[model samples]
Target: MKFIIVTGVSRGLGLGLTKALLSSGYKVAGCSRSRSDALNELEMSNDNFKWFPCEVGDATQTQTFVSDACQWAQAPLWGLINNAGIAKEGVLATFPNVDSDELLQINLNGALYMAREALRMMLRQNSGGRIINISSIIGSRGYTGLAAYSASKAGLDGLSRALARENGRRGITVNSVAPGYLDTEMSSTLSDSKRAQIINRTPLGRLGTVDDVAPAIEFLLSDGAAFITGQTLTIDGGITN
Candidate 1:
């Protein structure tokens, strides 16, 4: 079975993506800052699924996580999903310096560390692989109060484009998925009015779902998408338009 690495698998979109990948018969190496009961249950049920606790922002920890994953899989990696990220919201003028730094560490540096290690493994395997970075619609279209978050995500998109160019010759493809507001815990804190406003603005008249996003990710990792790289696929219900 092909092995895939998915970070931030303890909850929300990460959890949904892990479940979807496992269901589709890929061996998944997943990680999060802490172990959740849901992830433990998944581990117990799926022999193909392994969970590693990691702080993706830490380069050493991330590298160790990927190395251990390679050992555990005992095979070449087929794909990687740099899905670990944290959201920090504040007006650009007063956004705490600490929060801004922390946001970029997790959202951008984390992906960088993980992708660097994953690329090492993929290169050693001498086989083409897929790397999918999870971004935000806010990256392309700025949102008030999310300037730091948007900057980090926009950096991730730029990273994807550069890596796609650098690694294409190695048979590895790099791309990103930018999703708008989804019906996940991250969006639960928004006020009802705010949520309604977002939905009304979405041409689909609803928030995006994990189900809606996971399938697109799955497709991007498939052979069909071999020719599609250095691109950002936005799943925002046309809100960015």
Candidate 2:
């Protein structure tokens, strides 16, 4: 049997991805800093799904989380979804160094650490695997007050490209899924005017949803996407265009 590790499964896109994978018949081991009632409910209802507490930004915690999840699954590592991330909005000059540092540490470095752990296990097993990082449209198209958040996501895309080249020969694939402004908690703080502006600019006339992005990820983890790697799949309702 094969199982996938998904980080930041407490809510929003992370939680949606977990449910998508579970429904797609894949076993999932998910991690987050803390548990929510929704997450606990999911764990209790699904035998194939498990949750662990982990601070993605902390290397030691990430290491332990991965190790423990793997041990509990007792199955080959099939894939990893680096979905755990946080966003802080402020122009670089005014953005607190501490906040920027924390954003990068989790959004970028945390993904690297998780990829490293998953790669090590995949290599030892001599089997193929998948690593899909959840990036954002703001990474490529910069925003006025999201300098640090943009940089972190851009770095994640770069990480995917480099890792794809390094692991393709071993039958492993790495990619990034950059979604447009979504209706998740991450974008909940958007003001009414900002939200309307975003919708007006987007060709679809509405913000993207978790449902719109999850199926693409489900496809990436499938054999159909074996030939696709080192690429960023933008699921933004043509907002980037």
Candidate 3:
């Protein structure tokens, strides 16, 4: 069985990806800062799913979580999805004192910690593996109020490329999935008019669903993507184009 570790599995895109992976018969181990009621309910019924309460930004906590997961599952870890992130909005000039620091701690540093530990595990196993970082379209393109969020995700994209090159010889393929505006809690605060405006600009004429993002991730984790690495697969409904 393919064993996978996904972070931020409490809600939104993370939760959706967890459900999809479970339905596809993969053994999934996930972590979140706090367990959601929905995740608890799903855990009650799914034998192949395990959820951990972990703060991915902390190096010690991240290491412990992966260690425990490997011990409990006793399986070769095939994939690691660094999906935990935070979005804080503010223009570069007048951003609040704590905004930039907090956003980077979670969105960028957390991903680095998880990727480090996951790569260590995969190396020891001596088998090919996949590492998928969940970035954002804003990572590549700048927006007015999303300076901190954009910077962090941009860092993630660079990290993915570097890791892909470093670990390619070990059969580990590192990549990123950059998604555009998706209809999730993260984008819920936008006004309906604003949402419609974004949709109008997208070639698909709609905001992407979590489903659209999950399949790209699943495909990257599959054997078919063995030749693909150091790339960012953008699922933006052509918004970037």
Candidate 4:
């Protein structure tokens, strides 16, 4: 069985991806800041799933988590999803004491750290692998109160592109998925009118679901996408188009 490692699997898209991957029969090692009751339930029923508590922002902890996960799976890692991120909202100039440093650490640096460690494992295994970075539509387009979040995701996209070039010949592919406004908990603060405005602008006339994003990720990691790399697959219901 293929072994995959996913970070931030406690809730939302992360949880959805974990379930989807597990159901698809991949041996999954997932981590979050805290244990989720939902993931705990999956563990009780699936021997192929393993959970770990990890603060992805901490380099040491992330390294240890990856090491332990690889050892537990006892197989060469096949794929990695850097899905742990924080959505910090604030205007560019005056936003009540927004910690700029913390924003970069969690969203950008955390993904970088995880990709770095996962790359090490993939390289050592000598098997081609996939690395999917979860980015955002806002990463490409700017918004009023999300400068930090947008910047982090933009950095992630750039990093993925660079890594894809660096690792392609080594049998590894790195790509990004940028999702627009979805019904995830991260977007629950949108007012009804604002939500409607977004939906109306989208060609699909609806907000996306976690399911919509997960399948794109699965495809990118599949053999059919072997020749694709250094690209961002935008699943925005045509909002960006």
Best candidate (score: lDDT): 1
In candidate 3, what are the lDDT values of residues 1-241, reduced to their tens digit?
Answer: 8999999999999999999999988999999999889899889989888899899989999999999988877899999999999888867899986888888989999999999999899999999899999999999997879989999999999999999999999999999999999999999999899899999999999999999999999999999999999999999999999
TM-scores for the candidates: 0.99, 0.99, 0.98, 0.97
Q: On residues 135-225, what C-alpha lDDT tens digit does candidate 1 reach at each position? A: 9999999889999999999999999999999999988999999999999988888999999999999999999999999999999999999
Off by over 4 Å in 3: none
Instruction: Give the better candidate number (3 or 4) by lDDT.
Output: 3
Q: What do the candidate models score in CA lDDT, each in turn? A: 0.95, 0.94, 0.93, 0.92
Q: List, residue by residue over 1-241, the lDDT tens digit for candidate 2.
A: 5699999999999999999899888999999989999998999999999999998888889889889999989998999999999988877888899999999999999999999999999999888999999999999999999999999999999999999999999999999999999999999999999999999999989999999999999999999999999999999999999
**What shift in Å separates residue 125 of candidate 2 from its native position after superposition?**
1.0
Question: TM-score of predicted model 1?
Answer: 0.99
Candidate 3 is scored at a TM of: 0.98
Clashing pairs in model 3, backbone N/Cα/C closer than 3 A: none
Least well predicted 10-residue stretch by lDDT in candidate 1 = 86-95
lDDT (C-alpha) at residue 28 in model 3: 93
Predictions ranked by lDDT, top down? 1, 2, 3, 4
